[model samples]
Target: MTETKKTTEKTLRRFTLSWQLALGMASGFFVIFIIFAFVLSQILKQYYGRLPETLYQWLGITILLGGLFVFGFAFMLTRYILRPVKSIKTTIEAFEDDPMTNVRADRANVNDEFYDLVNILNRMIDRLQSLIGAQQQFVSDVSHELRTPVTIVKGHMDLLNRWGKDEPEVLEDSIKSSLAEMQRMETLINEMLNLTRAEQIPIENVQEVTEVGGLVHRVFDNFKLIHPDFIFTLDDDLTQDANVKVRQDHMEQILIILADNAVKYSLDRKEIHFALSQTTNRVEIGIQDFGEGLSSEDAARVFDRFYRVDKARSRAKGGNGLGLSIAQRLVKAYGGEITLESALGSGSVFTIRLPLQRENKNDQKLSN
Candidate 1:
């Protein structure tokens, strides 16, 4: 019984807007007719005798015609006003049914109000499509990356299961191989988590300030101690230390990623240069390495997640290819940008540009 009641209510509520508007107009006309008849009767009885039957009939016919015209006009006007709304509804429904659909709301001949609404809807569709595409690509890449390590580990286990465990050397080699692959997988998963965190910096920590020069110096010193064979030089052109609105740890991580990349790619000339400078309103830090530089195409896409110029070499060097991507995300989160410059023979220089924090109201010009 409850189901039947719900079905009946749904059927009744399924009336379209046009019909509902027409019914409302008809009801209004009925009220007006009753009021007019009451007034006419009172006036006629007060001043004259009863009217003729033919005259009453003619009056009724005139009112009926007027009501029909008004009802039709109201229905047509309602449809015209709701045209854009219907178009938007239809497009959204289509998109919801099939996310891959490229349909967008039509904006032609719409009023200013609906034009803005349609524009916003179109922009939202574009953003959603972009995010969907990126998500699909990321999933595909992750699956591809995991397949090799997973296969290697599984193959070794199968070997050990098939009587290889009886041989001491074979069992030991298989165990080592499986452990290495598992370690690789663990590293890849951790880097993925770090990339996710980089994309979403906490809003409360956005105002955290760090001294740019001090952090750079610390990174430089640490790397020098770690890689003593390589030549390291620091060119600090900033007369006074500059401050930026970013967490110290985040800034240090960015520096470390770039510095580590510089150290990794150096082949013959094991030299790294750290340069820090400030402009009127900005601070710039650059890491330069005399290394195996990249081609134009490689430099363009070097910061992309899981992108490496030489995939085999990067894997051998224990790089999961998420470092630069994480650095880029962190820099942009704090309203800064990182850029790269390199050629086939010449080495690369990765530079980070950030807005310098103002010390006080009187501070205007920054020392070059």
Candidate 2:
């Protein structure tokens, strides 16, 4: 009750800008009227013994007209100043009442502060609409993707409850199929979580400096060990050790993802290339795979969540199709970029570019 009372008091005490401006103008006019009346009375006393009754009447009439004019002017000026604010308020209220309705604050004819404010508001509304559309689409896609496995599992459970429990073959197959579907769902959920996490990297992680060359070598060696049959080659042209403003673990993860993708898509030729090079201002890591490459259209959307060149093959290979999306998000978070070059039946090369972390000479001198 006390807090509510305090909040109510604060709200009641708050003064609107229009009221403040009106009061200020009215006060200034009142002060000027007092000064003018005093000066006129002094002039009358100096010029004559006493002021005339007619002069007093004329002064009273003039004061009345002046006061009325001052007040009227103040009211109009306040209204003119607050017109834009009222328009913005009405637009926001309408938007709040019907969020789906695309309402925007009207822009002013003059390029002033209010015009800039209107532009910002329109941009914010557009962004909100876009986010709402994307959110709806995302929810729909997730539901569609999960429905298949859920339905399959439920169907198997119903079969087992009816008669499959007694038959050994039916029970075995149903159990395996159900478990597989459950595993796929688990994988899908994890990837979705990873994708979300990739979008919002921690502030501390942004400040982290990672040596790119070592991470590249580590991932290359790991992949070689995992795929002994596949030929792996590393081309390291970086004469000096280069660092980037990215977490070591994130860099390693990106490399592993690209390498894994290369291994997965390699149809006949089991050859993968890991190239590490550096320019003056950036470090580049390229993972080239002689795999069943993608078409131009597929390559364009390969980084989209749940997109796959071959859905059946992707499912068969236990791919949830979120790896590239996560990689792309992580790369972009640190002001890096990931590019894909592929031609059907030729090969694919995934290249990542990261800004090199510059060494602070002052810090180095301080350490010395």
Candidate 3:
């Protein structure tokens, strides 16, 4: 009963501007009628059939007085009705001047609708703040990561040129180091460019119906060719079903990034495992490596841009640290999720979960 009464009160409070204006006009007209009735009746009784002219004067005065009163009352009602709207306008102007300002209305004295709107605006501002913070952090990380590699390449080249002929072996190693650093820098720049392009383009630009198994096999084949020393294996439990709706190129890039990371970080360089599985509603692809796995803290930040658990080793192995970050972004762009599981001294597994297209009921029945 209390809830019902509260709901009815809420309904009554939600009056539109037009409805309020109409009500104010009606109330003003009712007041005019009351004044006219009282004044004309008194004037008619006072004259008592003696003089209609005297009654005419009093009737005119009554009409004039009623008009004045009604106008004044309506003016006051309009001002009262527009007060909250004007306050909201002023608050918005202040927020525009400084987006970080926590400007909020006094909810206890305002309409519930206005109060709710202010709450939603505050929430939106909070989200914008978080996004801006993340962008700033990304810029800082990129600058630091890129600067170090460029500095190393320059230093090593300078040394090789100064004493290259006198110390041939030293000069040769310096050149190799410089070349490796340059390649690392190139990879980092390319990964960052790909991430930027992925964000700039529309989703429809890259959407396609791709064969998941075939794409994985192609990436694996490329990886094997590039890293001839490492043994790469593909387990094809998932590729049998061919109805996964995803961008073919994007999926291949994601797979390559994961496989490359696994191969680079594996301890024994024995084998890297790639497997695909399909469920009723989803498909999951996992890349597992038997490496010196990440600690809990490192695992938590593994996908962060330019973050590496073993920074020295990452530089030595020519990793730019942007591969996982790019892969994560690409997977998320397709309404998919990427997850990592790892433990110290154990292996790491990265999983990508993508939604599977449902087969039409008619087609399924026909096939059955």
Backbone collisions counted per model: 0, 0, 0
TM-score of each: 0.74, 0.78, 0.63
- Sort by lDDT, best first: what order? 1, 2, 3
Off by over 4 Å in 2: 1-28, 39-48, 53-58, 80-84, 98-134, 200-205, 359-368
**RMSD to true structure for each model, in Å:** 6.4, 6.7, 9.8
Total colliding residue pairs, candidate 1: 0
Candidate 1, clashing residue pairs?
A: none
Query: Candidate 1: where is the Cα deviation over 4 Å?
Result: 1-15, 29-62, 105-131, 193-214, 238-252, 278-282, 329-336, 354-368
Worst 10 residues of 2 by lDDT: 9-18
lDDT of 2 by residue, 103-220 (tens): 7777765248688887787777776665666567567767988999999999999999988967988899999999999999998888777776677675354677899998899889
For candidate 1, write residues 1-368 as lDDT tens digits. Answer: 99699667645553466689767876787678768876876787678678778868877887788678767877777677777887798679778977778889999989898999999998888767766765676677679889999999999999999967588888999999999889999988787767766765654457778999989999999999999999999999998879999988889999999999999999889999999999998999999998989999999999999998998999999898889999998899788899999988679999999999877645554532
Q: Model 3: per-residue lDDT, tens digit, 1-368?
A: 99699657645654455347756785768676877677767876787855568666876677678766775676676656556665665556566777656675435566665777766765666656555655665577679877987899889878877887799997889889898877877777777777655544345555477778778778888888988888888888863665566677778888988898898878875678888888877888899998888998999999887788888898778776778888988878777899999987788999999877667899799999
Q: Give the range where candidate 3 is weakest over 10 consecutive residues by summed lDDT.
A: 198-207
Q: CA lDDT of each candidate?
A: 0.86, 0.85, 0.76
Identify the candidate with maximal TM-score: 2
Better of 1 and 3 by TM-score: 1
